[model samples]
Structures are given as structure tokens and as C-alpha cells.
Target: MKKTAKSLLALLALMLFSLSVSASAFAFNDIQKDPGKSYIEQLQKKGLVRGDGSGMFKPKSAITAQSAVTLIVNGFGLNIDNIRFIKEPKASDYFTKVKDNAPYAKAFIIAQLNGLDIPRDIDPNGKVTREQYAHWVYQAISKKGEYAWIEMYMTFKDEDKVTKGYMDSVQKLLIGKIASLDEKNRFRPKDAITRSEAAVILAKGITFVKNTKPVPQPEQPASPLTNVRMSSEAYGTEALKVTISAEAPHAGYGIEIANVAYKDKQAIITYRVVKPDPDRMYPQVITTVAAAVYISTAYTPVLGGEVQP
Candidate 1:
């Protein structure tokens, strides 16, 4: 019986550890198979986001401008440079809603100090749309620089549908791989941003700020890869196809390409060995590269591609 008790205690400890780890990933009630789960957990781990104290993240719930600004301020580490004031600015001075003891009071001040274009009469609890959040986050990162239009092709079918004054904001984010299209190749800029999606955008936005240089950068040596092509199409939903041809051909079974992310306005593709193909030992090994299809607007089905390596 003593041995059994010891075994039970060890099992209990292991279970507790697993629960703690899972809790760290998300104490939320939802988001088990959520694509945004990793991003949300990342921000939560960094202490830039949080669930209700009772342990519910409300992942699908709409986020507010009030909370979004706070997340931007905290997640991007913008509060490091304190804004001076002739007088200690009260929340009322900047926002009509936020009181000194209000939950969003400090965030409003940080947004003000950081020069966030928050109007005094703005509704604090209004649900923030994708375009609205994009504009604000873009400003926070750029330190309110005049957004330059890169003169890139607008591929999203509904690019014109973006709310006024937010097209450049969305485009800037798209160029940086922070904001992305829906599977329908639509920006859906006017849609309310869910907490889950907000987490992903904010995390990526913050990373972009940290990595960008203040000055123009010289180009790096191009990869040995060639004929890198990207295309967008709709299956049941929209999909992005990234085709990369290698300098030389690779084995059909061994060559695999992955990590189709956006970089420098190109579909950044990564290749890795999934496993060895000992069975395909033909007379000779031929070099070839594989094309990967990331399905969905955010990521989805592959548009057909051919890689001639």
C-alpha cells in the first residue's frame, strides 16, 4: 500500500506539471485547435496580454479600442520612453471616459504619451475594427511617421473595400506580414477584430518594430534558389502558392519546402528534410525543389506550382 501511495503521488505531480504547462499556453476556456493559439499564448507568456483573473481568455469576443491601445503600449515596449507633462495629465484630459481608477486609465496615458491619435471624445468600449486596430498599431510602431505608400499591386479582391484612411495602414502591415487577407482574399477591414486575431497581429507587429532598422539596409545575397514564384487562388477558400526552384535538382522524395511566410513582399519559403527516403534509391539522385501551398487567406490551399531546379 505504501508503494502504491508513492506511485500515486508521483503521478499527481506529473499531472500537475502538465496542467501548469497547458495553463501557461492558455488558461482560456476555448482555443483548443485554434490557429491563433500559439500567438495568443506567446503574448500571454510575455505578459503583454491576459485573460480575466478567473482564467477565461474570451478568445472569440470582440476586442475594444481601449484594450487594443493598452496591448500595443505594453506589447511593443513603448512605455520605456516616458512622455513629459507640464502637469501630471489626468485621464480626463485625454479621454472622456477613462477615470483615474479605471482599468484603462494608464493605457490611455501611455497612448497619449506615445502620440496615439486617440480623441478625447472617443468611445473607450467601442469594438475596434481590423482597419482601426491596424492604423493604431501601425502608428504606434512607426512613432506616427507619415505612412509611405510603396506602390505595390493590391491583390486582395476587396482591397477597395478597406475603410477610408486605413488602406495604407493595412498595406504596410501586409508588407510586413503582420496583417493578412482572409481565405477569400479579402482584407475585411471593417470586421470586428476578435481577441484571438488581435493577439497574432499585435505579436507580429511588435516583432516587426523590433527587427526593422531606422536606416535603409543594403540588400543581402540572394539564396541559391531561383524562379521563386507566388500566386493566389481560391479552392473552397483562398490559398497562397509559393514555388521555389533550386540552383540544382533534388530528389523527388527528399526535397520538401515549408515555412511559407511573407518577407520583403515575397512569399518567404523555408525548406527542411521531413525524413529520409531510403526506398527511392533510384539509379541516380536527381536534384529538384518542391512547391508548398499554404491554404487560407491567413494561410490555406496551394495554388498549383512547378519548381524546375
Candidate 2:
């Protein structure tokens, strides 16, 4: 009986150890099984996340500052090389110790430039709080909105109170209709947001921008000389000659001619005539034309020798 009890105790101890290991393991599906699974799946499809090697998303794990930077960088396809790091990010600024050549340093810098809520006392090693995660996500999506909404909503009086403004913004991003209100019809702003929740909000914001119609630029007037009229050659089989003339009161004007089919209205044809400075006495002879067929030509005038035309 003594031997049996000892064996039982040993088995119990082994089970406890196994449980502890499992808890520490970064299982990907932990987030996958969330009620907001569909939204999470959308984010995964967009290459925003990859579950653990075991095909599980560790949803509840506290995301680190580095991890958050990686996600925001990858999600928005930001350019890291051009990023300017804070003039002096002190050693204590990061929760995890930031090495000089850390791969995500540029990403972190970019996040800060774009107004991400990077903790001033950056605990590089510390877990990212749910509040911080939500704030960052809001900033990322709110960039397009010019941050007007984020600034207003972030000024809430209480972190836990689901203000009407907060609910409105959350509803703005339906996330496959998974973002429902609590009993008070308020979104718990201070609550730690799960990975699944983050994914849904991102997807909704992306969809909103995609669906919006882009503002159309006003069309400019077409050039006056749609077609050029050339007098027949004054001599034998010598090609027909044409001269274009223009004058700028203060400076010289550049004249260009091209075939009518040219896509860029302002693109000048090198083969066509180019007059640098036209004397007021003599009109600028843009080009001497020689073609078998009388094709229509387009002319453009650029002022002050600027390349903008």
C-alpha cells in the first residue's frame, strides 16, 4: 500500500509539471478558438499573423512591444529603412533591452513617428497591456481618418466606461459583425483586447477604405492645337516644314509636338521639334516635320524651362 501511494504521488507531480509546461507554451489556437475566430482568420489570410508551429494561435499571451512593432510593420507594409529613431531612446525606455542592431528597431521608430502609444519607459521585456494594444490598433487605422476620431475617443473620462463615442467607433468597424456591445451598450475600452478582436477591427477598417470612392481630380483643359495644318512643301520631295510659335511676357516658353496617340499629354517627343528661346521678332520654329501621311499632332507649351510639363 505504501508503494502504491508513492507511485500515485509521483504521477500527480508529473501531471502538474506537464500542465505548467503547457501553460508556458505559445499555442496559436488559443486565439483561434475565440468567439471572434472568423475575424482572426481574415487577418491570418492577410498575412498579419501566423499561428504557432503546432497550428495554434496563442491568443491570450501578452504581446511584447517588439512583437507589437512587428505586427504593425507587417500589417501596413511600412518602410523601415527611412525611419528615424527617436533622437535618444534611453536604455530604460524599452521593456525589453533594445540592442543597437535589433531588426525591429526601425519598425519601432516608425510606430512612434506614426503616433503609436509606445511607452516612454519602454519595458522592452514587459508584456503589452490590452489598453496599449487597443490604442495602437486604433492609431494604425485612424491614420487615414487624420486621427480626428482617435484623439476624441482616447480622451474618455474613465477607462472602463463604454462611452457612446467608443461604441460608435467600434461599430464603425463591424469585424464580421462580431463586435457586439455589452449589457450597458458600451464597449469596454480599458479591457485587454484579444488577438481575435484586434484582427476583426483591422479587417473592418481595411474594408471601409477599400469600399470608399477615391476623390477624383478635376480634369484639365485639352491643348488648343489638336491638329497641325502644314502648307505644302515649297520645293520637291523635301518633307513638309512646320513651325510652332509661342511667347511669354516675362520669360521664354518651350514648345513640344507629338503624335495624337501619346498617353501623357505633357510628354514631349524628342523626334518632334523643341524650341528653347523664341525671339519676339521671329516665332519659335518648334520642328520641321516630314511624314508620308498627315497625322494629327498635339502641341504643349512649358514656361521658364521647368520640367513640370
Off by over 4 Å in 1: 1-26, 80-82, 144-151, 216-309
**Residue 197 error, candidate 1, Å:** 1.2
* Candidate 2 lowest-lDDT run of ten: 299-308
Q: Best candidate per TM-score, number?
A: 1
Give Cα distance to truth, residue 19, candidate 1, Å: 7.5
Please give, for residues 1-309, the per-residue lDDT of candidate 1 as tens digits. Answer: 999999999999999999998776566656667789889878877988888876678888999878888898888666624322213455775566777788878888778756576766777788988888888888787873343446675679887778768877788888878888888888888889999889989989877766665555465544434443343445455554434344333443343564555421224345543334567644444455554555444532222223233
* Candidate 1 residue 280 C-alpha distance from true site, Å: 87
Give the whole-model CA lDDT for all candidates, comma-separated.
0.68, 0.49
TM, every model: 0.59, 0.45
**Full-model lDDT, candidate 2:** 0.49
